[model samples]
Target: MDNYKFILSGGGTGGHIYPAIAIANELKKRYPNAEFLFVGAKDRMEMEKVPEAGYKIEGLWITGLQRKLTLKNLMFPFKLISSLLRARKIVSQFKPNAVIGTGGFASGPLLKIASGRKVPCLLQEQNSYAGVTNKLLKDAVAKICVAYDGMEKFFPAHKIVKTGNPVREDLIALTGNKKEALSFFELQENKQTLVVLGGSLGARRINKLIEKKIGFFKEAGLQIIWQCGKLYFEEYKKYNSDTVKVMAFINKMNYAYASADVIISRAGAGSVSELSIVGKPVVFIPSPNVAEDHQTKNAMALVNNNAAILVKEKDLDADFDTVFSGLIASKEKQEEISKNIKNMALPNATKDIVDQIEILLKK
Candidate 1:
């Protein structure tokens, strides 16, 4: 078991990729000599991120199918065939004791082939709504590790384990202090700080909403730390001032979480898991563009518990001002939301996930 070899596959976004990486890190901790090979789609963020996290990764020629007819859609069959062949080759050669998939386009072919070859497989589904890839591979995987309740609607009840999403280690415990965090972001200690996160690529609607609300935020006696994402940084950086900090990305999220009085964020599963652990009052703006509108479902899971607030995209113009103002004005509301959200945090999620993987490997 000490020399166990494992293949981890999941990618396309930070939501899927980070959970896979977190699981691998935990497995590495348990078995120091274990070998891990990550498989992801070519040119996806995981190709860069997995290696940066100190793991060897291979990329398959694959991409998700488009909704409308297009050249890429026509190429889907060929890409899937090529990816399956490559995945089979990897599995046969690596002979992994267990294959873990976190759910993405890349994981479909890899997990399909590994499970077909009789290798034990486990899946981690991060969203409240299951991804297409996870659902397709549900029967093939021995166990499905899920973060939210009611996943049996998408996955088999017997195959499901209610282990929350694995968050990045840095976010699990913010070691930085408020004073240093304030200094790091160059914000005034007297002003209440609001942090805006639009995921890695930024959200167009959210960015526009923030742009229009700058004066509103200033009037509310709040300072801002806005992560506009790399694609939109240049367009929004002009708004940066002493009270409003703007950046393409945040390298030190621990400090950002530490300095925040309130947070406005996209409802990605990874963000939800991290925010729960951070235990801050948050307002979620779920992106409507994703498959199955999973973001909305992810937000509703917390909003139902009164652990967070949700302002839909269509209602942002009308609801955001009133909702934000009401929340900010009430210290009692903030503390109540913060405490409730913290109650939902699964601090030992990574460890719990790895324990399931161990069961599969032993079988």
Candidate 2:
């Protein structure tokens, strides 16, 4: 426990990277003197986001292979080899007590090298469906932390721990701030509110749906806070008004959740976890473009429990009006979803994940 060193790797998307950061922050609090190094894909968002979070991060020459045939697919082997070699060098020089992965391309090489070097390795798999890199490295890791149940289907039962995904701190503290949140968003308490989230980069389908039906929502007396994402803000910003607020991002996500009576969001693991804690009725629009279409799987876990509703991107045209109008009109359905989703929330997920990692350090 004396001046312990730890290496944590996760990247490519905020879903993976934020969990790694949450874990790192928790570990730093517990082990005040511990050293940390983060490894992320070279051109991925994590390289910028990690340093902004105040941690030293090294980049690996890694990228996921394209599903369709392309020139990038041809460079896959070279990238993999270079990444593995770089990963080995980093692990060997740092000589960390523990290595943790939150599931992205860089984690594949880093954790593989760490496990081979006999360093204790831990994994946090956020999705209901496992990523390819997580599945490939499953057997070698010391402990596997997960957000959902039935993950034994993907990893060894003995090593799997049901610790929910780590969410942003503000969103976790949202339950009590409803009045303040309503004021923050400048919405009326008497009106129903629907919050749309597609993450910062945006979801093309969700944005399109909002554009098509903004008037319908306003006419129905629903106050809307739409985070159309950074990529789509310019195109959709013209829709913003007193009743409808549109932005590239919502810096105060806690307020957004508090102001929301019903939320319409993409079913990424992090968003699902946040929605659960907020304990509000949610409609999940899972992105089909994600690897293995795991977003749908993430949404289904809640749907099966009657905790949330899922509207596939392809089915939005036929299903959105019925599904949305029904939810907005029924107070009973909203309460039922709220109660069920609260039951599924793992509020202490960050603490629980770190508890497992600490145990790994002892072994």
- Model 2, runs deviating above 4 Å: none
Q: Least lDDT summed over 10 consecutive residues: which range in candidate 2?
A: 168-177
**Candidate 1 stretches greater than 4 Å from native:** none
Q: Write the per-residue lDDT of candidate 1 for residues 1-363, one digit (tens) a residue.
A: 499999999999988898999899899999999999999999999999999999999999999989899999999999999999999899989999999999889999999999999999999999999989999999998999999999989999999999899987887766879999999998889989999999878899999999999999999999999999999999999999999999999999999999999999999898999999999999999999989999999999999999999999999988999999999999999999999999999988999999999988777
Model 2 CA RMSD to the hidden true structure, in angstroms:
1.2
TM-score of each: 0.97, 0.97
Clashes of each: 0, 0
As a whole number from 0 to 100, the lDDT of residue 9 in candidate 2 is: 97
lDDT of 2 by residue, 1-363 (tens): 548999999999999999999999999999999999999999999999999999999999999989899999999999999999999899989999999999999999999999999999999999999999999999889999999999999999999999999987766666657788889888888899899998888888999999999888988899899999999999999987888999899988878887889999999999899889999999999989888899999999999999999999889999999999999999999999999999999989999999999898887
